[model samples]
Target: MPQLDHGANALVGVMAAFGRFELQQELSGLTAVQAWNLLSPFLPLSQTDPMAFTELLCHGVTPAGGFAAYGASRALAELVGLSFDTPAAQAVLDGGIAFLREAGVPPMRVRPYEWDRWLDTGGNVESWLPVRPPPPPERPGITPLRPAETRLVAKLGAEQDSNRVFISRDGTDFVAIVDARYSDEDPTRARWVWHRASTLYLLYLQVGRSLQTPPHWVAAELEAYVPLPAPRF
Candidate 1:
């Protein structure tokens, strides 16, 4: 059994929290804090107790819940040099996403209007209306690819191309859902969509390791990276 480091332990707690919050949000469409009374029992002795943490996860987190949890876990691991690209890490992430999809949590999307309001109001925005401004057109040599985007493209074995990038009108952020072949004619090439929630998960892990509070802009940037489904409500 591998020992849990400070960073890993903190990451487990973050994942657990994210799992709980995502479940609550999905079931009620509301974001609420986990009640202290409800969460105290499963608290780990330290940040690196993967066993205790995994046990708690087994008891409370489902597959859909795992999506948020595992995503956060992987991000934390990556930041702390914990080998996120390992087979174990991949299993955790794949299992979590599968679980969420099976549980009927809709595919995630980016909603910029809500994000803007969240930033303006210090995360007190209440509306879910689709209201974000269109992302600035992808400039020829100006836009920078986020770390996550770069990592994901590399994972997909695709070369980076500026023309391949597109921005969501709702969230006004860059997206890397481009052809794996980097060709205009082959529409069937692989494309991966990166979301704000996923990026937020990464940021949360970063913050947890530093034990530092992130400014609202960090959250706002993450929110811009969130991917959303078509409007249904």
Candidate 2:
């Protein structure tokens, strides 16, 4: 197992990797209000005023464009394997409907049969279920997998590579990398880190891993270790 200091260093290195990949850019620009507007339509009608959601959806004032935005956002979420009928989405839709009704805008006119057919054609239904398998168990006491585990190899050429192994603070067992992203220099490494972190977080929650607090160091390492997705304008 690597020493705690080494683990900490590795964590720092991974966070640097995330910076290099521009992970922060993905989150930096949007204001809270914009985010609310984008997400509000998806909220449940029962818990919120449907009119508000509908208005948000319809207020942009373009028919095909509005529907396209909604469709694209929903499709992307589905592709990323999120649920379609989530309370959040429902609420947003309800608000949009109400807004349109009040404005006397014609109903967006997606026939149920036609909508289903469109969804089928777009292959959007595949990601309707949000459940995913847990990541492989961290090697015995190695603690959880860090973002570095996904990127170090690709950054340094395999021949120049150094392996990072660690023992869990519990002082039992150890985790050694089986594989990871190519290296710090590889652009894809950052994204790999993000995906790896997301997967690990999900797995941790699914398996009920206990932590005294948020693992900031681990998060930093992940952001550094993997490439991030591009920002959405």
Clashes in predicted model 2: 42
Q: Write the per-residue lDDT of candidate 1 for residues 1-233, one digit (tens) a residue.
A: 33334344554555555544444545433344443322343344325554444433333332334444543443333333343344444445444544444443332222232233234434322232323332333421223355444422212112343223222212444333433554567545565553332333343232222212211122233333323222221
**TM-score for every candidate vs. truth?**
0.26, 0.21
The C-alpha RMSD in Å for every predicted model, in order, reads 18.7, 20.3
Top lDDT hit: 1
* Best model number under TM-score: 1
lDDT tens per residue, model 2, 1-233? 11222243332332233222222233445454543443343445313543433333333221323233343333223222233354444433333333222332221232243244335445232232222233334522223544334323122122333322222211232222223336667523222111112343333332222221112223333322222221222
How high is the CA lDDT of each candidate model? Answer: 0.37, 0.31
- In model 2, the runs with Cα more than 4 Å from the true position are 1-27, 30-47, 59-178, 181-233
Quote the RMSD, in angstroms, for model 1: 18.7
Q: Which ten residues in a row have the lowest lDDT in candidate 1?
A: 208-217
After TM-score superposition, the amount by which residue 196's alpha carbon in candidate 2 deviates from its true location, in angstroms, is: 20
